[model samples]
Target: MKTTLSKIVLLSLWAATTSLFADSHGDHDWKPLFNGKTLAGWGVVQGYANYYVEDGAILGRTAEGSPNTFLTTYEKYGDFELKFEVKVDEGLNSGVQIRSHSRDFGSRR
Candidate 1:
């Protein structure tokens, strides 16, 4: 009787743990926006810029003696919240514009 009860309890515990783990895995659904290989969906507005994929991140660098560079997403999003980390070199002249329209004549910031 004791052996049978212990086996049943162990089986029940294992089943519970497996169900919990499975449920946890099903709760997350995150989609990537960039394909990281080519600028298929992104739009380049102005300036001499270098864009490439490195370390699973989209990187844009302004070269020396280059004009102001702007990389804008091709897909225009409205009423949406986006969170990203912008790391600029110290004392680097960099500007980012979000939800702002550019000038058709000269690509104003």
Candidate 2:
């Protein structure tokens, strides 16, 4: 709930409906990615920021002397729907990329 680009807990589904949080996944067959208690099954790549679990949500805190960090899932998805809530400072660089293994273009990685 308080993380950056890729710190969200993903729920993959064949189809995404408006009731993504209707207290049920019977229609969409959603599968959660993150456990919400730890960073298990996730990997950090491409940047130097810090990501961790806190208060039943993931937190991605940017640090000095670091580029845009990514907390990616270990498993790959062909196609899916994602619903998330994010809180980041205005004007800070952040985004989530789906199905693309490549980093942003012109990265100083």
Per-prediction tally of clashes: 0, 0
lDDT of 1 by residue, 23-82 (tens): 335554333346545656666566655655554445555555657666666665544334
Q: What is the lDDT of residue 84 in candidate 2?
A: 51
How far is 12's C-alpha from truth in model 1 (Å)?
A: 45
State the C-alpha lDDT per candidate: 0.48, 0.55
Judged by whole-model lDDT over C-alpha atoms, candidate 2 comes out at 0.55
- Where is the poorest 10-residue window by lDDT in model 2? 9-18
Off by over 4 Å in 1: 1-32, 103-109
lDDT of 2 by residue, 49-105 (tens): 676776656666666777666767777765565665544555556666777685532
- Indicate the worst ten consecutive residues by lDDT in candidate 1: 2-11
Looking at model 1, residue 93 earns an lDDT score of 53
Give candidates' CA RMSD values in order: 19.9, 6.6
Best-fitting candidate, scored by lDDT: 2
109, model 1: CA deviation in Å?
18
